[model samples]
Target: MSDTTTVGPDTAGIGRTRTPTPFRRLLAVETRKLFDTRSGKIMTAVMVVLTVGAIAGRGLYAGPRLEVLIGTAGLSLGTLLPVLGILTVTGEWSHRTALTTFTLEPRRGRVLAAKCLPPLIAAVAASAFAILVAVPVTAAVSAVRHVPADWDLTPVALLGWTAANVLVVAMGLALGMLLLNAPAAIVICLSAPALWSAVARIGSVGETLAGWLDLNTTAGPLMEGHMTGGDVARLAASVSFWIVVPLATGTARVIRKEIG
Candidate 1:
């Protein structure tokens, strides 16, 4: 040590920095987590079974018109998909994994984005699955009923159905993130529409507001693939209230709230 005191060789850089986990890796983990739990697996199985059963039932009675088949499956999926999204978020807290998750990925927003994307993907897949199932069912029903199979679903109708499912799942994710409690999130998500429907039926003023802000009314046309410009405007308003506000507020809370 002639000129300078000996220092540890570049130790400053060794422990001071860590490469952040890749976003794609985080997304893959989140996607797997969606089906890794017992409840999650059960819920997924139930959704698939119900979708198949609903389509089959319609084939038996209503003669599996493509619209009827898709509509029936969409109804079942719309209800269940949201529940799936809700569980994806609430389970992190319920299972006491949020602390670890935040520790591994300090940026909570990325985590939330990761959580949101998979459900939307699932929603799209569910719609596609329904369509696949409908094809054979439509064929069988047309044969049995001695009627022409109506595979006349336009691209617009298909797009609308897919969008509707995604919106419902988004609403669920927003509510789950906002509440961070599975029971509360599920309850509110289920009841709010009914409550709004009741309020909408009360008076003309209420009806007018609901016409714009009620997702049930606005999103209904999407399933039928008959959205007008007015319907699009109303859907945007309803989604802003139900999905955007809650998701934004919930994300902010998650970012700042103390993790236990």
Candidate 2:
């Protein structure tokens, strides 16, 4: 045997190694994490329960006032979807599985995009489910309670609302990445709307500004068939704030940050 071991080329150390099936592999892994967690399961259950409860409540309790019934449906949509959005992103951070996620997909942007895909799919499904539940439930409730539960189901408005929700889920994912703490992100998502409403109570300018910033206020147009120019502007701005800004910031951070 030779006393000295044969040496490989030192140049081999200088080249970059590449992941073979990076995005595809990362997408699967990220999606699996969503289904595997207790938090994700709990959130899913809560979503189903809340959804069914909204249907039942609307069917049983909605009285003669069509506006009240419509308001109830809209509010229910607002509450449940945002909660779903919050959980979609925050679960990973809450479980400390971000380590495994980031580790597997060292390219954080790709990982974030992967994480977003499942929730976007869920949002579409949830939107259609909401409409399905609302229609039959409203019909039954209107008949039994002797209430006029009437509204036009504009396909364009429905599509807009569905897209809005998908964007909301994306926003939640971005918030999660930006905060890296589940509870904080949840609190922010929950409180921000309430805070905007409170500020809206102050004065005219404050109210106007709040209407611009408050998702609750902005959501009215999309929920209804109004779709006025101002409403469209506010909705656009709100979507941009949550979906665009946070995503850009989070992607930048994830790209540059040191991973463990």
Clashes of each: 0, 0
Per-residue lDDT of 1-260 in model 1, one digit per residue for the tens?
A: 47987786776676677888899999999999998888879988999999999999988888758988899998788788999999998888999999999999999999989998999999999999999999999998888888989888888888988999999999999999999999998898878778888888999998898888888779988877887898889999999999999999999989999986
Q: Give the candidate number with the greatest TM-score.
A: 1
Judge candidate 2 at residue 252 and give its lDDT: 84
Worst 10 residues of 1 by lDDT: 8-17
Tens digit of lDDT per residue, candidate 2, span 1-260? 76998888787657677645567777787667666777667776777667767667766765434334434544555555555655656665566676876675666667677777877787788767767767777777778877676765566767767766666567677777777666787677767777888898899998988878666578677766578898889987876777678878877876786645
Q: Evaluated with lDDT, which candidate comes out highest?
A: 1
For each candidate, the alpha-carbon lDDT, in order, equals 0.90, 0.69
